[model samples]
Target: MTWHGRPSRGPSASVRLDLREPARRARPAVPHLPHLTASAIATWRARMLNEHGSARVFEGLARQFEGAGFEAHLVEEVRGFADEERRHGVLCGAVVEALGGEALTEAPVGEAYPEHADDATPLESALRNMLSICCLSETVAVALIGAERIEMPAGELRDLLTQIYADEVGHSRFGWRMLDALSQRLDDEIKERLGDYLEVAFAHLEEHELAHLPEGSLPPPEGVVYGLCSGPDARGLFFDTVEQVIVPGLERHGIPARRAWMRRHGGAGLS
Candidate 1:
């Protein structure tokens, strides 16, 4: 799945996404109990907004790749990834609706741009964005989804989580594949520069507060069984994913883990 250079034709020509059947099969056999409280509905709405934002970011990345003269296959793959994200948004919206929450009709505020990208070269910015959104964010997403899945009882909610998890795994791998391919052309200095951006990207992610749960609180039975975790559990998942999955994956791809940055930020950083 590595792309050394541009391909003669794009994947859009041959690749198509059949989202309907899987989505249909993944639907819950029995109706979900409408036990969601106002707070819970709000939370689900927020998640729907996040998924919408993710779809937009992926769409932006696809355009960025095309404009930067990346391989046609890679560009098309990213485009397909954008479609997947959009589908994820729809799925999340369905959950929100089922929980008695309205779909977020408006687009989420702000946009996805890498920290320090303003002054970076176009290729550098693209790489940084790739690492942030695909590598870091999607990897965290997989872990979070897994945590939620564990607490979720067997039902439509768990089924939905499974579907989303599978897509996220592929999305994370897409980032690694691109990084591996790009490594062949990028010099050590440039790769190191890209690696440095990981710290900034991670900091930005924390600042955005994408999924922070409260400290020392027990997991809410209602939310946990419905694909949500407690504050403490969410925070634990974020850090664990970074240390266990993200750092090692980056290191394997020749990207530094920026352990110093992590240590300066908190305890037992990434050893």
Candidate 2:
């Protein structure tokens, strides 16, 4: 469901997929079939596509940061993040293949919101992109991945997920660092603008994670076994991450956490 709010300015430019093929290095063969059902395989492939798609978003952010004359160090950090995301896509593809799915080739198409808005200033766009992708999405991903890793039996899947989790922690930290640096420049107008965008970003993230399911439906059992949370668990984690981690962090950096927006959106609703 969509949040009730003013329409965000649509993406000014489309994201270009990074069509570079993953390295052709041989992967270790799985000794036995994974306990995944057809639906589980499909979920894994979808996640693979999502990971692959993220490379494009990160690349776009890197380009935007450079074009906006952000600091050289931060620009380089973003570029490195792009490379890391591409690697994550490749790793995820390997997991899919191990689980009897076809290799991922095409990156998914989507905009990183803040960078997509034509009306926003470069810094505003950058801040929005950072908040949506890094602060919210990647941060939640780290928690999800860690939970999955904990539940997964010792196997190739768990190992690969662990690697991704490590990288995600760094990526989330990068978002925070950028936000902290950028916060120094945020006047009241920018801060208010951030508050307005926070609800939109939160809704966007919720859609990304749960849009395929019918309203009030839970994730399948295979999904839980394969490291995905049930609908209730996912919803709980999202809100908890916002309230306990993201919101507090933002407030510490002098940005409003927009608690009213969360309340308005039924952020407290059970899945």
Candidate 3:
């Protein structure tokens, strides 16, 4: 799937997918529906605008990663992520604008860490920092795209969302592998820090955040793959990664993920 470079200004660009059944078998992260309406749609759109920043965010992260001593390979990986993130900004911005609204171009919904910043950053490199970015971030994105099946208006918008979703899986897998490789050599202190970082990241994801995100179905015109327009359990699906996936993986490494890290300098470091 590819971004058609079209503005998602209507029902056409907004699509949702129902990957709950498949997700349950895979990780048990499913969206439970109640009801949906235009208000719900606006709520989700506003949430995205409030939570996520403009395309500048992706560009910012890319520059920061490159400035850091990250491997060329890792930097390249961030490029891919940046591409997707930039496109998401465009698609989301278009959706909100088309709906006769404005997107937040100044402050972002979530706070961003600077490139040269210390452990005060969410992108702290120690431990599972990369994993949180890749595995956890991408995993939730994939599930979110799936949950869209119920909420998406069913058309071109659905296609764009899915395209973004599919790409996230690979990104998540790559981050997972990177962490897995580092896991063997990492110490218990680093693992503890990773756990703490992941916990913090999870706090940023609330159900209401992505609840109204649109979804779509393929080979449409016949019928939608999921519900016409239903609401999913945004809260449950959002944090599935840390609770169900990443946390367990950390535990297997004997890492204490739930507890807060006591030290200020403990995390992926620059030195």
Candidate 4:
């Protein structure tokens, strides 16, 4: 998935900048300086970039909500998530700094969100994106982050993880709740359309996640202290979240999530 509804970056799109969060509170102590490595520091820096990018994604989602004619209050709530994601980015950047890495990253060029389909209705388009963004992606995020948080000991890193995890839970719930609200109006046809899109959505989700989460041996014990995790471990958790949590949750709403998942292949069912 594409991040929908982001504004164009125009002329200065590729500028490199420190994506750090402005300090709104005291900086948390950075533990495990002795455990730091180039790779680990890079990981934290990458997280900083990812979190900042999420802001743009959420901003697009907010616009989709508006286009779908969701309630004004709920649309505004979705809009607010952009700021929260920016805060998470800043927090991750701080950790990178504390680890002696710069939070500088190239601003993504052509910052535009895509319309999932040319023929889909505004509501169908919104449903497709929301399910992909929040239900699948954010739900997986909640599980992965929560797992890392549990492995962490008391410290700034753990605290940061906790904050992010809570927000992710909210993000995931927003999609589910939105679905519930729209359920009465979904009708059989709309529900079938959504089920059809699930195959494509699940395929994209798997491809994107697997690319980022490597298949490898676990990280050393100290890596966990710095919020690092084994690629294999994270991959396992991601699949588990999709199968056990996301699929079942969607099925409850009369979606054929299991069938879609089983039949999923890259780009299937997309127009």
> Who wins the TM-score comparison?
4
After superposition, which runs of candidate 3 have C-alpha atoms over 4 Å from their true positions? 1-68, 94-128, 150-154, 206-232, 239-241, 258-271
Write one digit per residue (lDDT tens) for candidate 1, span 1-271.
1100111222232322223333343333434546544555555545554564576677778777876788898888888877777777667656656655555444423534433446777778778888888888887777777767787788777787688788888988898888887777887888777766666777776654432454654535766666546766677667777778888877876777756247434555763
Per-model lDDT = 0.64, 0.64, 0.46, 0.76
Clashes of each: 2, 0, 25, 0
lDDT of 3 by residue, 24-110 (tens): 222211132223223323543443442233234345555665665567777676666666555555554444443444443333233
Give the alpha carbon lDDT tens digit for every residue of 1-271 in model 2.
1111011224454444332244224232443435544545565555655665566777778878877789888888887877777676666556556656565444324644346556788878878888887888888877767666776677666777777788889889889987877787789788877866777777777665555332454555555455544555655666777778887888777667655236436565342
Q: Work out the TM-score per prediction.
A: 0.78, 0.78, 0.58, 0.88
Number of the top-ranking candidate, with lDDT as the measure:
4
lDDT of 4 by residue, 90-204 (tens): 8777776777666677766535776675968988998888898999999888888888889988887788778878888899899999888777778888878888888888888
lDDT of 4 at 233: 81
Off by over 4 Å in 4: 1-13, 20-26, 33-35, 266-271
TM-score for candidate 3, residues paired by index = 0.58
Better of 3 and 4 by TM-score: 4
Q: Candidate 3 vs candidate 4: which has greater lDDT?
A: 4
At residue 197, give the lDDT of candidate 4.
Answer: 88
TM-score of 1: 0.78
